[model samples]
Every structure is written in C-alpha cells, then in structure tokens.
Target chain A: MKKIASIIALAVVFGATSASAQTLKTVKDRGILNCGSNGSLAGFGLPDAQGKWAGLDVDFCRAMAAAVFGDDKKVKYVPLSAKDRFTALQSGEVDVLARNTTWTSSRDTQLGLNFAGVNYYDGQGFMVRTALKVKSALELGDASVCVQQGTTTELNLADYFRANKMKLKTVTFATSNEAIKAYDTGRCDAFTTDASGLYAERLRLANAADHIVLPEIISKEPLGPAVRHGDDQWFDVAKWTLNAMINAEELGITSANVAEMAKSDNPDIKRLLGSEGSYGEQLGLSKDWALNIIKLVGNYGESFERNVGAGSPLKIERGLNNLWTKGGLQYAPPVR
Target chain B: MSIDLRAGSPPARVPFYNYPKVRSIAYQVALCAVIAFLVWGAASNAIDNLQKANIASGFGFWDNTAGFDISQSLIPYTNQSTYGRAFWVGLLNTLLVAGIGIVFATIIGFVVGIARLSKNWLVNRAASGYVETIRNIPLLLQLLFWYNAVLKALPDLRDSVKIPGGAFLNNRGLFMPEPIAQTGFGFVLIAIAAGIVGSIGYYIWAKRRQDKTGQQAPVFLVSLGLIVGVPLAVFFAAGLPLTFSYPEAGRFNIRGGIEVVPEFAALLFGLSIYTAAFIAEVVRAGIRAVSHGQTEAAYSLGLRPQPTLRLIVVPQAMRVIIPPLTSQYLNLTKNSTLAVAIGYPDLVQIFTGTVLNQTGQAVEVVAITMAVYLTISLTTSLFMNIYNSRIALVER
Candidate 1:
C-alpha cells in the first residue's frame, strides 16, 4: 500500500512539472487563454445565469488576451475557489490567475509566483447594520462577527481585536456567501472582510441599506493576478498588462479615445500606447499591445467603474484604488 | 507461468536453492526492493518539485505564529499561539467531538437495537424506522440539516429562549452556566478519586471472599456507598468550592456563559445520530446471533427474564458485537472530518484548511493531518481490539 501510494505521489510531482515550464508557448499553441477566476464573488468574477463571465478579474484576463492576440474574446475564464486558485496557477492549469487573490509577501517570495500588480487596494473592514448604531470598530466590544473560513480575513479579525484589546466572538463559514448569509440573518453582530468584499457582500444582504461599513481599514489586501516563475515572458506580459491599464487611466486615455491618443505628439503618450518605443516588444508583444488592451477592455478606471464601482450594482467607492494623481496609492512607472 | 512445476515434486531431488520455499523468499525480497525503489523515486521527485517551486520543505513552519482564530477549541488557543499549538488545539477538538460521539452513539445504539427486539408492535416499528431513516441519509446532508434547518432555525440571540438554570438558547447555541473551580476544588477531586479506589478494592475483596466461603457479602451496597455517598459527604466538607457563572442576557447576545457554539452542537448531533444507526444494526445482528436456547436455559435455571437478558444475552451479544463496534468507532472518528463542511474547527479544518492555505505547505500539512487521523483510528482500534479479545468465547 505504501509503495503504491508513493508511486502515485511521484507521478503527480512529475506530471506537475511538465508544460508549465513554457507557459506562454503552451498558451499560444492552445490558441486560447485559460484564466483562473473566482466565479462566486459578485463584483470580482461571478458568472451570470447564462454562463457569461463578468467581473474586474475577468476583464483583466481579457485584457491580457487582447494584448497577446489583439482579441479579448479569445480568452476563457475558469472559475476557481479560494483553495484551488493558487495551486491552479502553480500547476500551469491556467495561463494566468486573475482571481481576487491577495498579493502577500509570502505568496510573492515563496510560492514560485509573481503578483503582477495590485488591481484592487482592499483592506479588512467591518460591516454592521445601521440599526446597531455602532460608530467604530473599536466600540464593538464583545461583538459576534461572522467571517469566511480559511482566508486572511479571519487572521486580520484576530489581529485587529487583539491589538485593540477588545473581546470578540467569531462565527466562521466555508464561503463568503455562507458567511454573509449568516450575518444577514442576525447570527452575528458584525460582518468582516475586505472593504471591497464588504461592499459586494452588503449588496447581497436582505436589507442592503441597513448595513454600514466601518471606517477602519485594519489590514492591507492588495488583490491582483499572479503568474508562475521561470516563464519570465508570461510574467512580464501579465505584469505589463496591469501597468498599461494604469498608465492609460493616468494619461486620460479612455477606450473610445485610445486610438486617437496613440497618435498624440506627447512623447509619454506616444511611448505608453507603444507608438514610439519597443516597450511592448520588450515583453514579447507587438508595439501596439497597450493600444490593443485599451481598445478591447478599456483602462483601469473604466474597468473598475464598469464592474465594481458606482456604474455596477456593487457601488463600491474607489477609495484607495484610484490613481496617485487623485491622492490614491495606485502609481505605475513610465512605459519607457 | 514460467515455473516448471508439472510434477508435485521434482522426479529427482531438486537442489534446496531451487526449492519453492526458497523461490518464495526470493519473490518476497524482489517485492520489497521494488517498493523501496518506488518510495525513493517519489521522495526525490517531491524534493525536486519543492526546489523548483522555491518552497522550503521542512517542519519549521510549525513554530511560526498561526495568526488565525478557531471558533471552538478544547485547549487554550489564540491568534498569537504558534502553529504547533494550533495543531494541538485542532487535535484536541477532533478527539473531543469523536470521544463524545462514541459514548452517545453506543448508548443510543444499544437502546434502539434492543427496542427492535421488543414484543410490542409500536416499539419494534419505531426502532426499525429510526435505523432505516437515519442510516439512509448521507452524513454530510444530515450535518447541514442539523446546522441550518434545525439549529439555525432557532430564534435570534435577542429573542433567546430562557431555559431553566438561567441558560439561554438561540441560533447561536445552548448557553449554559460556566462552572468555575474555586479554591479547595482539589479536595473534591481527591474525594472522587478515593471513592473510586475504595469501591474497586471492596469489589475485589468480595469476589475473593465469596470464592473462599459460600457467604456473598453485601458488595453492591458497600461499593455504592463509597462511590456515591462518600462523594456527597465530601462535597459538603469541601464547602462546595464550585460556583456557576451564569450567562447574562444582553441586548445583542448573551455573555459570560459556556456557550456550546452551533457549529459544534450540530456536528456532534449529526455524527452521533448517523453513526448510531449503523451501530444499531450491528447490535441487533449480534443479539440475534445468540441461540434462543441460551435465554430459555437461563430462565430454566430460575433466572428472571430481565436478569436472563442482562446476564446471559448481553454478555454473549457483546462477544459478537465488539469487533464490528470497533470499526464503527473508527468510522465515527473518521467521519468527524465532515466537521469541515459545517465550520467545526476539527484537526483537518484548522491545520489543513487554514494553515495550509496561509503557508502553501500542502504536502506537509496533509501529511501531518493524515498522521493524526491514522493515530486516532489506530489507538481506538487497539483499545477496542483488547476489549473484544477479553470478551471472546473461551472453550477448552
């Protein structure tokens, strides 16, 4: 029994090593991009009843495909749960993982992966019903909080409570939907998760208006896509796709005006749209890669507002996700 | 197929080296070699993958701060505790649920199984119905029903049902008073220990004295006095060094009570009820295996019906019941992993679910979790095996 078990384990390890070494080439040969996603999350990667995928994460993968093949429609979204997301990306089962996964130091340094860039600057926050009249998280002494299990949200809950020396009782569930449902039905006094998730989950509540998100942001949760190491070409493509979107958003280049802006006289705009330099080719793509991405999926601001921001049902305010020019932390280096 | 074995024995005396026994030994050696080779190959492959992934492989992560909170634990645990300590908490919680489930499953199984053999129509039908209904449903679905349809269907915390002893009940769970062991509670522990020892000594003495003389002492009364009456007398002597910390009804929820969270309560109910159904069938089969002549003979020897069932039927039924009962205990313990589905922080949930996700040490986490469950099952089987052997039929 032991020998048979070990043989199977060995087969798995050997199997996991293949084809992943050349992620970009495999993706190109497959003629379709496979992107990992969180299909259950409302504003991030949920699929509609007709199986059409829509979310900020979905758009990010579409933008990658647009950059590579100049057609966002060629990408396929593979919905993944929290536990399967990282392993899926690591095993080369997906070309890119665009789930709303947090970019942590451990994930970046040790997971043989590279986080492209922060697409959402979310932080741990608490949500309570307005009827509770609770003003601050600190005032929530001995509060019963509902949280999703096996996520960083639970750890942050412990840290925030312990640092403030407040008593608390936590009710945990296997998924965000389950946890939010528990909180909605008065099983807990407060619901806690990322600020972005709090907004999305509040929209799921029976009385969305009754809940209020606490102002305190306890922990930094920089959620973004990640690519496996060794395939530097794929990593560069994933990283630059995000950078191009931010730069386009910063340069006032909307999807409708990107083609016109590519012809601008300004050197910065010209280089950003890949008109004056080999920046796109440096990442093994055409000089017009950024222009293709912008045309297909729009810039960062457009995607955010269209998916999770006020333009969507989630109505999540772009607090820290806004660009640096707007007093937010989102800053991308020059295309040059 | 390659062996030249048309004759039962070689026409001439075959060399001992080519003997079947020698060939069998060689085959066994070859099998061992193949197994060792496969294990080595797998180990090397695992090491290579870990290096390629840049994931350091070691047990070093056990000492790192867990930084995660489990809702229910039998041992002291906190976010600040080490991962090693969190593992212990997970282990203890798994044992706690499985241990409680085993005891309750046995009691319910015996009762229901015996009820099925009752002469009354209603009693027998009820037992069979319970066995059929509970055993047919999947354990996971039953857990969800217990958690959502039953426990969660209770009123909100503010509208908690006030039970006796100042306890509160709601969707949260049953909140009973916490017993605070005050000063001198150690004396109560000593008295209980003494009572157990005294009862055991008296029973042994009575058995030996009965063998020597035909006079049977009042062993039951004397042992009961030491075990029950002495403990009561010492409880007054110790000034009752135990107080109840009743949970106060608060605006949002109750406070300061020993709250049995809904997750744990639901899991315990599901595990015990589901396991009892299987155990009930096993018990019924064991009881039915005994010949009707055994009961008749006991009655013919002037033993009453109740005493006949208790002294003759039960002891023999136990001999048949114990072996399958052990596996049921093992099954119940293993099924407690279903606690993962309902948010119970069992060993698999806290360590494999949360810690493995946080650290991305799937191989290590899975190995440890597997080992823990194996140890628990093996220990339970070992204990049950001893009891089964002790009760096995002895014939000259």
Candidate 2:
C-alpha cells in the first residue's frame, strides 16, 4: 500500500496526464456509458412516461456508446439541468455530456470542456401570441418578453434590442415552464428561447394554436456533446462519433443497410465502415467502430427525423442541420 | 467529598489531559484539525480537477461584462456594466425588497397580532384564520399565486386599468407618475426639514412645561400643522414647481413611468404576507406572555385605556417580542433569496444564478454570495441585540 501510494504521489508531481486518461478504461470496466442529458426538454432530451429517454441529444450519446461498445443499449443516461451541465462535465461525473448545451466561446475555452460537434444547429427565436399582431421581433419595440433566466437567450435578447435601438422589458423565469406559463397568462407579449426550445415549449402551452413562433432567429446556438478538455483521446472519440454519424447519413448508410454496405466498392464507403483502413484503430478502437455506430443508432439523418425532425412531434426541419452537400453546415472531414 | 492531602504535598495533580480545561482545548484542537484537513483535501481535489479540465479559477471574471439586462434594479444597470456593478445592483435590489418587506410585515404583523386578541369574536377569528392559512402554505406557492393568479390575471397593455394618480395597472406592472422635483422643490424640502427640527424643539418644551405646571400644550396638533403647513406654504409660494411624468399608453405597452415590475411586487408581496403570519404569532405570544394585572394596575394609576396598553402592557410585552421579532426579520431577509424563483434580480438571482452560469466559476461566485448573506444577517442581528439590551431586564 505504501509503495503504491508513493508511486501515485510521484505521478502527481510529474503530471496528472496518465491519471486523467482512464475515462475509456473506466467506462469499459463499468460496461456502460455514462451520458449526461437534458431531462426536461422535449424532442431533444426528455424521458417518456416509462422513464425511457429519447431525443436528438439522446441518440447522439447512444451513438457514442455504440461506437465504443458495439451496443447503443449500454448507456445509462443521467439528466442534468443547464446550470449544472458544465459542472457535470468538469467533475468527471459523466463520460460525455450530450445535453442540449450551447457551445459558446467562454464555455469552450474556460469551462474546461470541449464541444465535440454541432449536433443541433439552433438559433434563438421569439414566440408571440397570435393576437399580438406582431410580425417581426423588430416590431416589438415596447414589448415585454418572457424568457428563462441564466440562459444565453437573455444575453441574445439584450444584444438584439441594443443593436436595433429598441426598448425591451424582459420578464425572466426560473424554468422554461414558468416562462411559458407567464407568457400564456399574458404576463409577457412574447416568449424567447432557442427555436427548437420554442417548438417544444409551444406544445405545452394552454392552447398551442393561439401562439406563433416569430421567424426571426436572433442568435446562433450550436449544441452538441462535450467532453473534458484534457483528454484529447476521449474528446476525439466523442467528436469523431458525431462526424461518423453525419458522414454515414451523407453516404446513404442507415442502420439496416450498414452491414450490407461493408461490401461496397466505393473507397469512402469502405473506409467509413472500417473495411479499408485502420482509422478506427488510430482512434483507440477496433476497425469496425463507425460501422457499429451506424448499425446501432442509424445515421444522423435517421436519428434527427426519429427524435426531432419530420417523424417526431416537434417536426423541425433539417434547415441548418443538414449535410454540407444539402447546403447545410454539417460538414465532416473524410475518414482518411 | 473531602480527601486529605499532606501539607508537604505539592497540589494533588491530575494529568493535564484529564483537566476539564485541557480536555476541552484538546477536543477543540482535534475538531479544528479535522475541519482543516477536510477543507484542504476538498480544495486540493477541486484545484486538481480544475487544472486537469483546464477550467479557469479566481475572481478575474468579476471584471467581465454581464451582457444581460435585469428587469428591475435600484442602481442603473445595462448590458455594458461589469459583473461587479451587477453584483451591487442585485444586492441593492435585494436590500430594497427586504427593507420594504420588513416595514410592511411589521405593520401588518402588529395589527393582526392585536386583532387576534381583540374583544370582537369576528376580528379575532378572522385574524386567526389568516395566520393559519398563509403560514401553512409554502412561500414559493404563494409567490407563484401572486405572480400567476393575481398579477398576471390583470388585463394586458391595451386595456390597462387606470387609477386616480395618473397611474396604470396592467399585467406588465403598476406604472405610476414619476415626480420630477424642479427648482422650487428645493425650498419645499428645506421647509419640511425645518418643520421637523422645530417639532423636536416644541416636543421638549411641551413635555417640560407639562411636568412643571401640569399645563398641557397642543403639541401634536401644532407639530402636524407646522410640518404640513410649511411644506404646503412653500409649495404654493414656489408655484407648485413639480411636474409629473405620467405613463403614456403606447402601441404595445405603457411608456415613461416608474414601473414596479410584476416580479418585484410578487416577491415582495409573497415574503411580507407569508412572514407576517409568523411575526403575528410571535407578537401574540409576547403580548399574551405579559401579565393582565399590569393593565389594571395602569388604570389604578389614572392611565386611560390606550395609554395603559401603550405605556405599561406594551413595554413589558416588547421584551418578549423583540427577540423573536429579530429572528423573523432575519428569516424574511434570507427568504428573499427565493426571489430567484421568480426572477426578481435580487442578489441571489443575479449574482449567483446569472453570474455563476456566465462565468462557470461556481466556487468564487458562491463564496461571495455566501459572504454577502452572512454580512446582512450578522449586521441585522447585531443591531437587534443592541436594541434588545436597551429593553432587557436589569438584574444584578
């Protein structure tokens, strides 16, 4: 015991790099991926009646688990609120945080976390009642808007008002539900949040049809999985897992057809599924890592449509989240 | 219990560890050492984690721009203000609500406490019912009820209800006329101040004259007239030089009036009304704890009913009341932290909630907030303790 203790002390004195690089080993020993996700947001990271988690964010974590373990089901989802999301990542409480977290500059640089990739390209938008006769948020000169406090939405709202030289009255609430309730009860002329959040929140209003989300998306909100910054190896695993999903969607691979596509002649397809090279091995995984992800969680397009896209209750379009070939921002580097 | 020691013996000595004083000191040292070790361990662990994760630590984040607008603030705050100014703004707002809530809660508490002991059955029962209902429910729900059920139920901007003082009450808030004191208003303020000084002089003289010759002076009436008449005479003589900025109903909402946002009102109303119930109970217990015989003794000494209650019964009752009253006030101030639930921009809401989220420096932000609350609580209790000593029973 004394010998091991001295060795650990020596290791600490030199550097904690070896000490910090055991995340994958720990997950493998535990046999389950610990994923932090937003527990309350619908069509993004909400649990159903039976405590079954499902969302665009939820699917990304599952995809990560599948890449490493060849089984997406080996994931235990831990729910986190927005304020605690970064803390959860920094404290090593979760292996990967796939909550609907915005990748802001301060958060990426200072919060000891690295955003993997933009799984959901969202923007802040406003939702107003149909009776307000408001067309553009720019028309809301003297309007009182309700928004969740402690969010980037507050900063964005202030910025939008200042840039346009308008007076704004923002009534903030602790939670989105309270914000919606305040907006529903006529306390505010409009409710502002991420556009995806607006759609999800609009569903919980007293009468969803009475409200309309304004077309103005004021600020960009790129949300994705995040890992602690020190472990670039784990960071790569998380980042490339997202890249593989998007690449699989672009290459016409679904969960069902991924196994058959392993025999394809195309070099890119062969390389992506780990049939042509040792790219997966370089990332500290077996050659068939991407193949496992595509097989278990389907491609990014399938996950999106299943959780928050056309097939889901939110019905959000793949506007900013589509592939670069489809004129969207979701471009990934080649597997080679 | 006497055991004999030889005259030649140096005192019969117990080992230093067995001495009560030594034992207590030893125990204290052990406790402190354990606490220090725990703190050092936790801090080292946090520093290690922060370094490994590459997160920044320290108070440097206070200089950064907040980039958020609060709905209401006592001091002027904008997105351009640094986090330090936001901290003061939030602390001031918290003090504002807590100060206002303390005054209102005290006034209502005393009245309801007295009413609970009233001869009228209806008043007594009603006061009891109020205390039972309000304090029984959680303060958060009452805040929500006031915010959602009462305030939000008001008509929207276009159909705002107009009040008599060039004010409007809508779902947004109560918008009232802001008094702009111009050039002549200076004289009015000076006259009022002179009147107050003059009243104090008159009070001393009246008391002295009454004691000397049993000749009563109409001091109350004269002081009231002087205070009001001076302000009024100066106001009219200066041509009533005060303009009001009435809130004008605009296309979307009212513009250009002092606004008591629904958030502040809801939190203040909730804190006062809820805490007043507990204060009422404390007050009742104090008043009841006073002997009833004192009131009869005051009557025998030729004191009237009001004077008897005020001079004799209340003074003794206060000795009991003030201690619990201090605690209630402290609780009310601490309860003001719940303003975070309703977005009141109080210290906890803005500094801890918003600033912590923005900087992600939880340890620094939370420590500062904890220190602020401690300062407020300690200062309040100190003042109360001094006041308590004045009324405390003098026993040798």
Judging by DockQ against the true structure, name the best candidate.
1
lDDT of 1 by residue, B1-396 (tens): 677686576488788989999999999999999999977876777777667757656788899998878777777778899999989988999999999999999999989999998899999999999999999999989998888875568898777899988898898888999998899888778878898898888889888988899668898788788878887788789898899999997656678879898888889999999999999999999999999999999988999989898889999999989999999999999999888777788887777767766776666777787888899899989998889888888877
DockQ for every model, please. 0.42, 0.38
Q: What TM-score goes with each of the models?
A: 0.92, 0.93
Model 2, A232-264: lDDT tens digits are 888899989999999999999999898889999
State the lDDT of candidate 1 residue by residue for A118-219, as single tens digits: 999888999999988989999887888988776778888998899999877887666677678778777789999888888888877777899999999999
lDDT of 2 by residue, B42-102 (tens): 6776677667768789899889999988888778888889999999998999899999999
- All candidates: interface RMSD: 4.3, 9.1
* Second chain alone, TM-score for each candidate: 0.93, 0.94
- 10 residues in a row with least lDDT, candidate 1 chain A: A1-10
Q: Backbone clash tally for model 2?
A: 0
Summed backbone clashes in each candidate are 0, 0
- Residue pairs with backbone atoms closer than 3 Å in model 2 (clashes): none
Q: Which stretches of candidate 1 lie over 4 Å from their true place?
A: A1-14, A74-76, A257-278, A286-288, B1-18, B209-220, B250-253
TM of chain B vs. native, candidate 2: 0.94
